[model samples]
Target: MSKTILVVDDSSSFRQVVSMALKGAGYDVVEAGDGKDALGKLDGRKINLIVSDVNMPVMDGISFVTAAKQLAAYKFTPVIMLTTESGDDMKAKGKAAGVKAWVVKPFQPPILLDAVAKLILP
Candidate 1:
């Protein structure tokens, strides 16, 4: 079966871009508008990976990851932070929240795809 990836971002356009790329690469995608929405999406549906944006309304990425990690079903699921913020402090916070990879914004699809591939072993 194809792996499922949850993508959390405030931008609908960004989510669409990511969804298309993941779909093209033979993966299923679930999209959310923010951390709160993303949290609601963690419904024991076999999510293999997560790609999140740090800045969002309702709930931020780090807070969402931290909350998600506390859940029994998703504790060890790998997360990748795809955001415009690249500060050391922010990255540190994301690491604490169990983010496995960080990709800066305005990123190429291939670079994000590479990171996703490495984390999601076939």
Candidate 2:
């Protein structure tokens, strides 16, 4: 079965771009508008990975990841932070919240795919 990836971002266009890349790589993609919405998508489904944006209207990425890690069903799931925030402080917070990888915004699909490959186990 194809691995399922949950992609969370407020921007619809960004999610579409990421979904297109992930789908092209043979992965099933699930999209959410924000962290709260992404949390809803984590309803005991087999989510192999998560790609989230930091600056979102509802529940930011770090808070979302921290909350997600508390769930028994998703405690160990890997997370990748895809955002425009490149500050060390933000990255540090993400790492603390269990983000496995950090990809700055305006990223190429190939680069994002490479990060996904490293975090998303086969």
Candidate 3:
């Protein structure tokens, strides 16, 4: 089966772009507008990975990752933070929150895809 990914971000355009990129690479893609919305959509669904962005309203990416990892079903699932913030503090927090990877914004699909492939397939 194809890998299922949940993408959480506030930007409609960013979500569309990331979804298209993942879909084009043959992975199943699901989108959420924010952390709260993403949590609501996780009911009994099988998700192999997550790509999230920081600084969203109604719960940010760090909180989302923390909450996601608390769920018994998603304890070890890979969550990657894709955001514009590149500070050490943010990255450190994401790491502590059980996020497996981090990608800075204005990114190329190929680069992001590479991380996805490695984390999901490796």
Candidate 4:
């Protein structure tokens, strides 16, 4: 089965960019504007991985990762934070929330693809 990835970000352009990258690499992609929307989208979908943004309108990536880990179906889903923020404190917070990795924004698509492939398929 193809790996299913949930791309969560408030920026439509960023989401589109990430989705295109993932799809190009042979992964199925879904999109959500925020954590709340992402949770709603996850109801019956099989999400293998998550690429999220830290700052958003409804809910941020850290909250999304923490909430996702609580559900049995998503307990082990790998979530990577793709954001502009690269502070140590933000990274620490993401780590505490069970985010698998943090990628600074303006990131290379290949790097993000590699991380997703390693985490979801390894």
What overall lDDT goes with each candidate model? 0.95, 0.94, 0.92, 0.91
Q: Which stretches of candidate 4 lie over 4 Å from their true place?
A: none
Q: Which residue pairs collide in model 2, if any?
A: none
Ranking by lDDT: 1, 2, 3, 4
lDDT (C-alpha) at residue 118 in model 1: 94
Question: In model 1, where do residues sit more than 4 Å from their true spots?
Answer: none
Query: TM-scores for all candidates?
Result: 0.98, 0.98, 0.97, 0.96
Name the candidate, 3 or 4, with the larger TM-score value: 3
Alpha-carbon RMSD to native, per candidate: 0.8, 0.7, 1.0, 1.0
For model 4, what is the C-alpha lDDT against the true structure? 0.91
Cα lDDT tens digits for candidate 2, 5-92: 9999999999999999999999999999999999999999899999999999979999999999999989989999999999999999
Task: Report the alpha-carbon TM-score of model 1 versus the true structure.
Answer: 0.98
Backbone collisions counted per model: 0, 0, 0, 0
CA error at residue 36 for candidate 3, angstroms: 0.5
